[model samples]
Target: MGGIDREKVKGSFHRQAKTYDQYARVQKRVVANLLDQVRKEVGTPGRILDVGCGTGKLLAELHRLHPEAQLFGADLALGMCITAGAHLAAGAFVTADAESLPFIDGAFNLVTSTSTYQWLPALDHAFAEARRVLAPGGIFLFALFGERTLFELKDAHYQALKREGEVEDITHRFFPPSRVEAALAGAGFDQWRVESTLEVELHADVPALLKSLKKIGAGNASPRASAGLYGRKRMLAMMDIYQEKYGTTDGIPATYEVIYGAGRCP
Candidate 1:
């Protein structure tokens, strides 16, 4: 459980490929924001690479905005690639890994990823690979969850387990903003600027929130797996604790802390 297994992670997304678009609200928002940032800084580009291009939604938007650009979409999941090929603009889809892009170096002027970097087993290598694939002065726009995401739930779950004299491991993993920024810098990206904004959404209950995450093929893709089954009693107790702690003015509670970052490749 040192790091994520890329094949297993890819398979999870592949299984959810057909239904990913239906439940990817956070992803959609993040990608739109990333695209907007790109437009503001880099304007229209002649070539673009959509890394971890889930269903090619971002690629489609880019193609519409910059139709002249050669847009390429890459995802580790073949199913995602196929789905993207069918949904995205013609000639803009490929199956590839983020850490090892197949295209030549400096081929793309803009590289964008939406809601998919956290699952990478090695962020430094991935960032370096992304920098290598980008042309000089190219832009890299991405969105990932920060360490604060699901804090209440994670804390409550672990606290409950610890209180019961048991240890539990969760599948989700998130890095701090500073750590992410350092990785980007270490990857040789210059003019780097990173910012994180909190995005909270209300959920009727934990099950609903968990279901949405699963539908998007985004949950605990890390190599670490949860031990001890969360039975009905434990789940209910956990929910009670979460509600007591995080319930808002409204009846429903909120989950998720989304972090967005964008930088330029030197």
Candidate 2:
């Protein structure tokens, strides 16, 4: 995509609200790991906001862990907001963007997100918003798909397009760790910690992996994708190349580079 179509992202998530958790095995793990990290490093907060809280999974888990703490969830997709509202009936839910939250300054002591920031075109504004909404000593913790995410599939796609005499690099790319750090510094976080880990999910085949992506609302929103440039002939070619290169006895590996970042507000 030239730049992510925010509306498309919202629409895709809205459509997948009900089925998201079913196909979000990797996301669940990311949330669990992020929460576990917080429990070890940040402790419990008096008030918390989970940005892009899809279906309220992370917020529900947070409620279970810290029943006394205030919980708030925000998402751009209306369907996601509705679903989250049901699960967090006693808490608060809002349809909002990460870069422009509706909450007042210092409304929360902790802000958390997982598998959400990757969809954002840039992190600086969102990080600033997070800082703007946090109290002193509050923490901004998140896990996002790093630059290396989906490398194998992107490589295969590139190869297929090259073989078909196409030159545009249509594969979407993610931000690197340096960019995240820069954003945190620009947002004037008091201090920061950032790290990365590689996680892989196995699919029976390339087609199976593509289907799983769609089911999880991770479908490509590229202009090329809309133009049907990612067409049948190229798709078959990509599948063949992916199998030959990355397929194994167990399955084809789809790798995600998860970058976890934590910043403390002044």
Model-by-model lDDT, in order? Answer: 0.78, 0.87
User: Using alpha carbons, what is the TM-score of model 2?
Assistant: 0.96
| Model 2 Cα lDDT, one tens digit per residue, 1-266 | 24676777888999998888888888999999988977887777989899999899898888888898999998989999898887777568889999999999999988999999888888989999999999999999999999898899999988998997887886567889999889889998999988999999999999888878887788765534574336789889999999999999999999999999999987
Query: What TM-score do all the candidates reach, one by one?
Result: 0.91, 0.96
RMSD of each candidate relative to the true structure:
2.2, 1.5
* Off by more than 4 A, model 1: 168-170, 226-230, 249-251
Q: Could you tell me the C-alpha RMSD of candidate 2 in Å?
A: 1.5
- lDDT score, residue 120, model 2? 87
